[model samples]
Target: MSTSPSRVFAARLSGLPVFDPAGDQVGKIRDIVVVLRPGGLPPRVLGLVVEVFGRRSIFLPMTRVTHVDSGQVITTGVVNMRRFEQRPTETLVFGQMLDRQVTVRGTGVVGSVYDVAMEPERSRDWVISRVALQEGSKRFGRKGQTHVVEWRDVEGFAAPDGVQGATHLLAALDEMRPADLANVIHDLPPKRRAEIAAALDDERLADVLEELPEEDQVEILGALDNERAADVLEEMSPDDAADLIAELPPETAEKLLQLMDPEEAEDVRRLMSYEEHTAGGMMTTEPVILPPDATVADALAHVRNVELSPSLAALVYVVRPPLEPPTGRLLGVAHIQRLLREPPSTMVGHVLDSDIEPLRATSSLEDCARHLATYNLVAAPVVDDDGRLVGAVTVDDLLDHLLPENWRDTPGRPANPVRIGGTNPGGSRG
Candidate 1:
């Protein structure tokens, strides 16, 4: 489903018209624009080929557009209509595209890559992925920050110096979360957002969803296939799950739910019962659960077999035996790593910590943070009054509840660098 930046760029420029800034009718387009190719490689145009005086054909840089929509075209303010004249075919607008990598700039506050894209119909070309302004490494020094501008953003091929310098992009992209990625998309140009969305895989899309604004979730989800959408939804917390499902059209929601596992669907439905943002609404039902009498070997086997998040294996929950307690009462807790260190024949109940901290269905953020800090715990199990384990909350999830949106962007601040994909960028400022 993801398209390369070059492909997206080419698609956006094809049908768009070249206009003068004042809503003045200038001329129509003619041919394709090229960016980033070397000498004899390809001449990058901002956009299409336009015939201005109904005679001569001119290369219309996609960047010259003031407004682009299905209804009409508006030209760039930089071009004066009265003095304008047609140019030769060899003229290139995006000269810098010949051999350069430009990163997209984040909006004023959001930390994420900016999308870059050209209008379609101009010519079939690749769209640029979002630009990432990232600081390479602190040890390399802050000056190591660089912009990753994509070819899709090259509406017109001007010299590299002609492009506006986006300064805020690097700090913002550093250590951004999924929600941050979503927020960054909102600040970028529409063409850019579409390009980034088109480039991401299902799992990457899911990661971005966790950071996206709640209001924008459905629209983005609508952009994805039902299978990918369902997969991403399955990865989200129950509270976010309810918010997104509620926003989708009923039929769409139904179809996606059908595609999801029955248990996951049920959990989402249960979370939907409570109002948005409530403890019950936010709690997930996918916590790792094991029986009290199960041996350490059994628990380890369960940990290895079950599809739990990586964070979950660090902290697992032990519940009462289903046979002994039909309702599934909470027994104690065990650290997966700690359990592994013990003998395989050891009983889970014996190794489990009975004094484990637990959360009620209605615990507040403050209560959870304090518990996590006080106990030095990674996560806490949520148990109902009947002593049944329902869900668990990890420190990472709780941090989402505690951290500010742009905490890492603060200047001169040291942060624990976080990584996206499998690459570790090391720690960054909080």
Candidate 2:
């Protein structure tokens, strides 16, 4: 405890790299684990929520921590790889504590919790020692006064009342990827999840919703007003938006579609018309489609769009006139790798890989899978009976349908819990 920092602010600990004794980075700190006590006692620190590779969150008990400073946390090389599940006795410092409304005892000042500080006591156990509060500003366009006081001086942490805002928590997680943010939201209480979801902008919310489980997606979307929900759906990929709408009641789905932009709603409706397990059902209508006359430079520029998923960007669909979905005759596809080798001015049609057949709209899931595997393709075009390109199916789409419905809820296999210095007390159960 003496070697670690005397006081660590919870906000600063967010995303700090955690390493093992040999300098191998195991994960990054996402949140702190603590247990609240009675009689206004400081909450005892249990461990940390470390997001390891693959975005799996695991519990790293304080006992396994060798050093903790501003730069990074050093842990005993032996650690458990089991996913972290919140027990009833545990509370996440970052997820549940930040942005809580509180009051200073014996003082009329009232504010919201922005951050908390942790320090080791005489018993050599880390505990929440201080609370950072920000008062409401009286003047426009200016922040309120900030105060740092002992944990005992705060009155609301023990029994929080009123709705807690997500501003501070969102700030701490501002740089997180959508998938990672989805994971964090998945673990939070439903009410808190709704709060955070409401705070996110439409585009960000759409991305996070796409990564979340279907049930969670429905719940969060249901919480929003009709107009906002329709806007969020419009921000999602047409195929994804269709899938989510399909889960809603028929009336609700129709109402949302009516509220969406005409063009966006048309795309979603077209995707919805296909059978769920067919190639057209799973294909994205927004893949990089281009006219046969386009140059390699144009193809590359379109694929280079930062928003395009890697699999979708792996190939450019070459077609006749009418560049939008349901485009005229499917000419061929220009593989990104081959396009990279050709000169920028060369026409995509000249270098097309037309030998590989395109998938029909009615093709079954198994048929689509075999086509991709046989051709060693990441994505393949889907066409209608008249040979017009309707959409393109990527590997990710197939896997989503192939996996178990609850695959997102499943945890990884357990790993040995042997610490470099000693045996881990928490074992693999963590």
Candidate 3:
């Protein structure tokens, strides 16, 4: 452990890459595991919650760690592939400790815990030794005074339950993808999950909500006020928002729909009218769309939007007048690759691949899947009875509907779990 830093701040280790003794990258550190002692003593560092490939979180024992630095963590080359499950006796430093309100022992001053420091004790065991606190601020944009004190000097970690701020936790996870953030939130206690979900902004929450399990989505949305919930619903893709809303009580769903913006609400309502497994139900009303007369450059520009998903951005839906969903008529689609090769001034209609038949709104899930697979398309247009372009069904959307309802809860695992360095008799697999 000579190469390990003398002390490490938990906040700084949030997403640092974890590598093996052979220099193979394994996963990134998500959270630290610690066991609290009964007396007023520092909590013993147990291990780390490392999120491996497939978004499956696994435990990496401290004894297996060879070195740690600001940039990365080096392990003994052995990692348990079993999913990480929090034990009743253990606490997650980032998940359960950060943003916790505590009082100083001597002064009556109170503040929220932002970070904690861990160091190796005389026994060569890592322990939480320091706590960083930030007092509540008076100004809107300014943070209050911050203090770093010995762990023993802080109080309130033992409190049964109360509201916890998500500032620091959110900051530590700010760079995480929505799906990854959703995974982290999915593993938290119910109370903490709702708290963190509520703290997220409407757009961020919407993106995360779309990635979460249906039950978790319902629970988090249920925890929000009607107004805010409606706002969040509006932020989600129309199909996703409609699906989630359908899970709610009829009355609640109606209330939320009424509260949402008229235009957004209309899209959700139209989507909800279709059967769950139909093309109309699964398609996104906001795919990259362009009029037939539009130039290749215009189509490319629309697909270039950073916010659009890769599949949605891979093709431009060419239609007649009325650019919105249910547009006048479906001309065809122009693949991004094709658009890139064509002259910028060329009209998209001239290069359209209209040979492939479009899917009807009533097309079954199987039909939609077959259509995309046959044409080797990432997405296909969905049209109304009059052959007007209504929306586009993407491969991702199809897979989301085709997978088991609980597929999100069960992440894929490697056939053979990786193991290196002789097995440790003391290490817990999870």
Candidate 4:
């Protein structure tokens, strides 16, 4: 007996892994590209914007898909690795269709949208079944009432004939995760991409910029004035920021550096000294650090800072006195999980594990990956000859560099292209 095929909500299908018939993972579903039809017919599924190996974006025709499971997808052994480009008629259901002010034919601005519910239609297409609404902003924790309305009752934000693109997309885009937003930006026209980049807040733009390819990074930053460029760089991880700046011409890179906060510039400047192939070259200078005398409460507070990334906040590095910024001599380290298990009043120094040997600035890229894999660590501390904590090589950055260099260009044949003196002559190791 054959079982009925599974249907997934748009919100639930965002990151499902896509695999070929042989069970080989090609990429994951980043977004569904669709074209809205006139009259009452549902939107047609043009293809899928599959993110290959989490590094490259490609388009897969609907005919290529064989199955759609909860955690993964199955494809028919055919896929076009060329980058997916959005045409004027296309609307990305999850990336573009979501978060607009939903208007009911009669209700008039009933609420904001969170997702588009789609059902299988004729000819391997999926049509909108309903508009998923959140009573309040999904960006906030309100978890307001969720209402699903049939497509016929929803009139969209504008009249069908007057609709150009998502007019409300900018507001909805603001609530998207940086990675998701980055994917959307990557598919847009260069001019539109620059416009979106300019509109993002310093912090949001910084996060999204980190997700952009090196060429795009250079393009976006070069388009911005020196001061604005410096502001975004300051908001990015120094290591990532350094990688980007290193790609700029000496004069341009130097001008932006001068515009940055001296303290932050120093961090990027220090990382510039290392070869891109080394651990020091791949590390971030913003890991959480606490004085040897600090209590668990202090370590927790440091991790809670809004500016810290999840990777940087994963572990706390311990150091000696003069610890205002805690970039002193590296003493030991404690995972955030362990800190949470210990008493809040307990001194962090007592909890640090000395057994985890730190990586040197000179350690090779291979050595860094091996260290992280060996210990199953997300990030490893980087120190100099004197054992002072200089920065940390995060797993995320390491994985990106470890991939084949051309992964971005070809079915996998093409890609920093992320951050120093504009790119350090050492290369795009991080």
lDDT per model vs. reference: 0.53, 0.89, 0.90, 0.73
**Tens digits of per-residue lDDT for model 3, 1-430:** 8888899999999989888777777888999999988788999998998887677788898888889877899987777666788888888998999999999999988999999999998888899999999999999999899999999998999874978979899999999999989888887888889889878999999999999999999999999999999999999999899999999999999999999999999999999999999999899999988888899989888988989999999989988889898888898899999999999999998999999999999999999999999999999999998999999999999999999998865756643345633656325723
How well is each residue in 1-430 modelled by candidate 4, as lDDT tens digits? 0121534567666767777666677776777877777775666666677777545677776655667645677766555455666776677775456655666677654666777766566444556677777565456655666778887777663432332333235554445578767777777666656666676778888998887778888999988988899999999988889899999999999999999999999888888878998988888877887788899999999999877767778899898865533267899899999999999999999999889899998999889989999998898898888888888888888877887654444444322111112222221111
Question: TM-score order of candidates, best first?
Answer: 3, 2, 4, 1
Clashes of each: 77, 0, 0, 24
Which one wins by TM-score: 2 or 4?
A: 2
Better lDDT candidate (1, 4): 4
The TM-score obtained by model 1 is: 0.50
Worst window of 10 by summed lDDT in candidate 1: 411-420
Candidate 2 local lDDT, residue 199: 87
lDDT of 1 by residue, 232-317 (tens): 88877655576679778889988998998786788777767654443454566666677777788888886785445566777667
Global lDDT of model 2: 0.89
Query: Model 2 TM-score?
Result: 0.93
TM-score list, all predictions: 0.50, 0.93, 0.95, 0.65
